[model samples]
Target: MNKIKKIGIIGAGNMGEALISGFLKSKIFSPQDVYASEIIEKRRKYITDNYHIESFDDTKKLVERSDLIIISVKPHNVKDVLESIRDNITPEKILVSIAAGIKLDFIRKNLPEGIPIIRVMPNIACFVREGMIAICPSDNTPKEKLEAVKEVLSILGRTIILDEKYFDAVTGLVGSGPAYIYLIIEALSDAGVRLGLPRDIAITLSAQTILGAGKMVLEINEHPAKLKDMVVTPGGTTIEGLLEMERGRVRATIIDAVIKATERAKELSKA
Candidate 1:
């Protein structure tokens, strides 16, 4: 990451701008080290005004100037963006695609052979630097280059390296994971409100509880079941609630959610 100087993002939409935000928040890369290309003038202005990073409308120029280029455009727009910038990509430069369902081979076909490419699945939590990112690099990607990418990504949150085969699962688990958690939080908040808590207090308590539970699982170095046991005293109030949730099949439904989402991602990839 220290060796790589400029990071360019094409398509300064939500995810593209989020990457820029993450880069700046990381403190490893300053605004000067970031560049972007956005078709939308408003978004371009937003990037410069908010982050103080230079942005352009010319994709090729962005590629030519950047050390590592991230393709953050929509999946349907990937081919055109690649075609527009492919010639500018050199062997020493790294190209990363964060668009969901956009495969490495799909990106490779439009670029010169031996140009290293990386595919990443990152969630919305990236905006807050608490993201879960899954990275899969093309075979041509050098080991040292991959390490640099990992180092750069660490600021955003935890990263996992998996075979591209598991990316759809990653998408379901971590990429779309935040939305699932939000749904649970909402449900909990609503339950609190039903139990006579004020809306504002209910929401805050629900959110904090979720956040605290997640931190405990992560920081405690123990399995979640053991943690659950620590909370669920024998024949207590917690057990009664757990039994009710079990009766409602909540656990299986959550598992099915990820599975169903993964299947949908696989379908989208084929499309």
Candidate 2:
């Protein structure tokens, strides 16, 4: 519950590495204050050599030394990681998990009684420090501790505190959202290429257009429909493109994609 002086990450994958990178880049914690546990020798060596942080093959050792622990392993590996470090978890230490489909209750059941658990769902965008992260804390998590975690998460991107009940929806919307956006960008680039534009230029234009549109939504604080209306002059090219998109049921397809992904997330939680 005290200020986090030392942090340990349980995985060395992209998300784990991203957090480490963000933390160091933000100067919230120094490399010596951060530690990571990776099973692979090469990964451990790489993290230590590149980041100058302590790396270990033993999860228990990292848990023992860290004031806060972040579990960034895959969804299926969460329970095993919890079990391995269960005894090391104490009331004084806060635990955070970024694994999708893993719930706070599941983590609590795996750990010692009354251990504070925080569930986080961060998108792939976190790798670039432009992510949208959702955090859900267990009933036992102290307000101060949760705020401390939020401060650390802010370095990665925007952070929102939400009810655990909405996590599946968040998982679908933001967790899987990047892949959907990437697909849209790819399709737009392909369409440009088909229209005789250079492939590289098409990709750059497509990506930047999506980026600008997103920035407008965030900065203008207006409904996206209003923005679309502003772009559609009567009998214009934009309207023709909009009509084609409507004919293809693009909106419905995207909605279905999120729904289907949410359903799969629920299934994974049960598994």
Instruction: Give the winner by lDDT.
Output: 2
The weakest ten consecutive residues by lDDT in model 2 span: 20-29
Per-model TM-score versus the true fold: 0.94, 0.94
Q: Which lDDT tens digits does candidate 2 get at residues 197-238? A: 999999999999999999999999999999999999999889
lDDT of each: 0.89, 0.91
lDDT of 1 by residue, 82-171 (tens): 899877789899998998788899889989899999999998888878888999999999999999888777778888888999998898
lDDT of 1 at 245: 98
Model 2 segments more than 4 A misplaced:
none
* Residue pairs of candidate 2 with colliding backbone atoms: none
Clashing pairs in 1: none
lDDT value, residue 115 of candidate 2: 79
What lDDT is reached at residue 115 by model 1?
93
